[model samples]
Target: MKQKLWDHQLRARELKREALRKYGSTVCVSPCGSGKGTMIADDAIGAVSKGHTVQISVYRRILVEQIAERLQLNGIRYSVQMPDLPDKPWAIRDQHADVIVSSRDTMAAILRNGGEVRRSDLHIIDECHGFETLGYQTINKAVQPRWLLGYTATPVRPDGMGLSNRVFKSMVEAAKIEELIEKGMIVPVEVYVPVKTAKRRRSGLKISANGDPIQQWMSHAYGLRTVTFCSNIAESKMVRSEFVANGIAAEHVDANTPREEREAIFTRLLLRETLVVCNVGIADVGWDFPALECVQLLTKCGSPIAYWQKTGRVARNYLDEQKSRGVLLDHSAAMAEHGWPNLSPLWELSDREPIQKRQQERFGESAPSDAKPIICNKCGRGSIGLRNCPCGNPLFRDSQEKPETAGENLSLIGDAAEFAVGKKNYQKEWTNILYMAANHPTGSKSFAWAASIFKNKFHDWPEKFSVTPTVPFDERKRSIVEVYPQFMRRREAV
Candidate 1:
């Protein structure tokens, strides 16, 4: 049975055909979970129907198997070319098959070893962001197919190199992220950044020193199936251990984990037996789990490609009625550095300058000048280009006074005599102050910090009042704590 193509997929096919006619080879850029594999299968099937051979190359053995499954479902006869493993009944080595699904390393080795190389009418490269590698270049030189197609969610490279004149001469862009979300092809993401800054390593890579990941998960995405991308194997294991210690079921997997063991862990994750999977590099590409509701980035992503791929894990729509959207808990400040996931930059088929040079030439700073994210203090939601946060809180104020001066000049709503006369009103005011402290962006402040602020204002401790925090209704109270830094400085002094 042939799978039906969506409207966008059909349009992409037309664009790819036109590109191939003009340039002989083109890269197709589409969002993750937008059925790139389906398009690949469709193209392969079309070529096979015309009595032409097709060669599909992937970076990972797992992807080879996945592509094979898609070909099988489409009723296309194919053979697999992986490195190791005994010959199976389903995956037999056949050089004469109409479609050959192969790992890039295996194909490169075949060409290097002077093994049999089958010529194909169509060549499809999966995860084609890595097309600039020497291995892929070697395979291309050997096979030299009639029409070449490369597919990836991210077309740009981490090193700012271009693929235009090198290999792919043209690019076919598919649906935008916002269009996919509107059409219900992918879920919208709600991104949240911790209220703390990232620490710089000696190598210049930033590692998040934000608040505890487990606590953040508990507050934002508790009981939701999640995948945590860690910086290293040790960090991944530590994160898994912390999650397990906090009574959340979690499993850790890295490149070294055995194939069978990794499969078992993934099965448990799909079965909901495990709530979270902390992985390093394994779940970054081509690993699909539609039920994932949350993505926690404990790893700092230096490349925008990596940042998009890591966050795309949770963008797939789930069938559960309760799962309406995806949540991104960005502890590494990736959101702050790379803007939102849905904002698309103008992709080109030309060489890109280094990030520092680009930033310096454009903004005169090393940081991204456009779409600077501002986190809402009330809900901790990160957004860009919005006057008010989605939680209905004002993200910015109209005042032009400096924060130091703002704090020094402002006092409570009432005089000291009125504050003394009404103890009930004083306690209400104290509750509002504690609320602002708890919701501060520099990570939640301690109760002692709030108590100090209360004492500084009322000339006494708030022991008689309830310690519970509530949102302050008065605009002055909210601005004094958030806009003015004197409250934070006072806490440090105390």
Candidate 2:
């Protein structure tokens, strides 16, 4: 069932030459349906041609079998660790196959219990993030492949580190979502942010299981072929039950879903046999179905990796011209948090957020990006260069200045003029803006202070205060104090 590889797939395979020539280890990152498994097979064939033996390690047995199938389809010689295969190597040295495909855990046991698979000339870690595991470390110590290859779409860790530091020496991006969309390789996405929370309450019409709101929205817009990420198994089952009861013919895929059942569900989805499927993070990574047109986010996740992986499910474009635009339904308001996936930046395995990466490029490694800068209120001198003031009088530490850092997306505010806070405390904010815009009586110091507060609220530049209203000062002060600190993290990207 092998087909000719596309240009990006060929280009990714070609780049592996550089991976081996320079870094010894490299991560080839591309979106799903971009032929990653094909690229891996081509890589295996290339290495085998050069008289190099290869061992491809996958995180799971399911993916290992899939990779094995690809290798076989490509006419590449391979072996595995199954009981049915009499050639399944019990000892690493006995593995003479051109390409050996096995789970990372199996390899770990082989390396630990005196087995010999690590002796290959090249090792391809399929889901290379598993490189962080002790098994990977143990195997690497045992075999130490001359050329190492890692593959991942989201190559990062939650602790603000990239995979480059551990598994791959450097990473090569095969393609971005934007690049693929432009080339018509993937579908473009439309992000929708519903204002009201999705829930089943007594605000009723005839709805199933109190889940009428989401179903109503789905019926209004979005294809029936959908995969939803829920908070937990309970939520997933509830959504599935509701959809099934409503004649959508849906099912739930959870941690407990058997491998056979999971395969059947995915096959049914591809064959257009089901309308909607709900899962508790099961489909978050590595479920590639191009027919999926809608991704319903029912659970709120803070991880950008989870957000990116979940988003990739819908944008897969197999039919090319026949594929309509992908739709994202942000029931959990995740759109407001993570932004559109295609528009999101590509992060290296060891890199932090874009702003921090820029900060490292500018401020040097000694300085941390998250560390807030100290600005002098009296002299208007900020932490960008110096700490002390030139005026001789020591500038008092003003916590009130620049309270909001940047990174919470400022683009969320659609209408800046429509924003209002009717209170005396915000009036200070308003007055400060009016003064700053005028370059006024208190000098630029007040201007800077006001702009920070303004950016925190509007998430953008302020033009004019056409109306002045009156209200309680405490609430105004409280709201400003509350909003900026939380949103400031998103401003770092700017």
Candidate 3:
């Protein structure tokens, strides 16, 4: 087997052994890029060696695969028990694997009504910050564990609720982001903030009424590689189109897209073949993009927790020390509320003062003198126009960039001779484009149970419910859907 332990991973292993031996349950608050997955894998191996079955649960679909790969490389045998996994639900239940990974939502659904879990089974909750919410309360209560481990970079939610101290035991083991940089694990970030414009009466609220985060972020997109995160899908599409109009080849992705397309877009990004990828909710978790340099947080996420998660997407140390710094285009209302440097134990919030307009204008390039006023092609709301409509979208002209065209053909159906599907293409290309989505796995059958339980609970449109794909579209594109006529011509000529 490969020796896959880092110094940080070793430290986490020591802590895990101590936590299980002493408290039987513990919470570890670690920052992003800190190799939390490696720690989990090693700990799970230790548990399995002691005849304990381990369950590792996370928030997103991609996390399961990431953890599984680490476990496999460690010479540990494990099974992924999730709704989207290829195997049937719990096929390996009686045949216990060293570790079983799942999504938190699927676990919530299973525990909501009823599910079988042994008292001796270890439960590891990744992205434990999400458990602070209400829906997770029921699942948290139902868990019967031999030991529980909660992991998160950010624990406190903006809503003021926190993970029950009972679950985490308050024994957190962590390393700061700066420390990771010094250790050569994460790159030191260089931050740039642009001057924002005001939102007029007829103008759409791009960031806020006074702080135009949208215009500020867009102005800096002079052919730089970027990713912009928004609050909703509609908003993500609108933002992507605005960038396209400005000459950036931008794409947007939400939960509504098929699994195959999501995989392809993620692959293209890693190849640096795509520029900007705008998103609503999905990109904040397990997805990795080494080419990711600049991130525009145009949306006003209600909590510091969401902000940090978005920032982590671009924080990975990709060996390009030249691209060390990350720019936070805080056009939204965060500056007036949470302030800069947010709540990080790594760096004191008071250490870095908020950048005022006077300071920002001097540090970076100033807005162009004849900068064309951004007119919402959808509603025709100019930069000098009103706030957003009651519908939450800008009441302006129709967008010139069609959402469909903004994405390359993501439908993965075709004749086998012309297309090739693999893990690399899925992660680097499909995940970044507009209209592609990856399904979170809890268990193959758990989604139905979750869907039934959460139907009346969440604001999700029931009509939007459909079977999600587990692998990337391009990986088996020709196998899943019919080849588009556009690609068909190339295949025929070949």
The CA lDDT of each predicted structure is 0.67, 0.57, 0.51
lDDT of 2 at 351: 57
Residues 1-494 of candidate 3 have per-residue lDDT tens digits of 65577776677777767877787877676777788877777778888888887778787766777777777767676776665555632233334566777677777767765776433378788876666563544554555667888777766554424444545655555676667767766654323222222221112234442224334543332223677788788888988887677545678888887888977776666554566788887777556665576677767665656766777766676664344334445444343233223123322112133223222232212424222223333432223223342113463433423222111111111111011111112222211211111111121222232233222211132234332322233343232113222221212110
Of models 1 and 3, which has the larger TM-score? 1
Residue 231 alpha-carbon offset, candidate 1, angstroms = 1.6
lDDT of 1 by residue, 1-494 (tens): 77899999999989998999899999998788788877888889888988988889887676676667778887788888877745645566665678998888898888778897787889898888887653676687677799999988877788644465678899988778878877887876766554334112211344444657887776555556789988889999999999888677899998889999998998898776888999888887777778887888887777867878889988888765434467777775555455455544456677755332342232222435333434445544334456765446687523212211111111111111122324335554564565546545454556566666665444455664544333333432344445444444423111
Where does candidate 1 have its weakest 10-residue lDDT segment? 405-414
C-alpha positional error of residue 45 in candidate 3 after TM-score superposition, expressed in Å = 1.3
- Arranged by TM-score with the best first, the candidates are 1, 2, 3
Better by TM-score, candidate 2 or 1: 1
Collision count of model 2:
17
Stretches > 4 Å off in candidate 3: 84-94, 109-115, 132-143, 160-164, 194-221, 320-323, 333-343, 346-494
Index of the highest-lDDT prediction = 1
Q: Which 10 residues in a row give candidate 3 its minimum summed lDDT? A: 409-418
Error of 2 at 7 (Å): 2.8
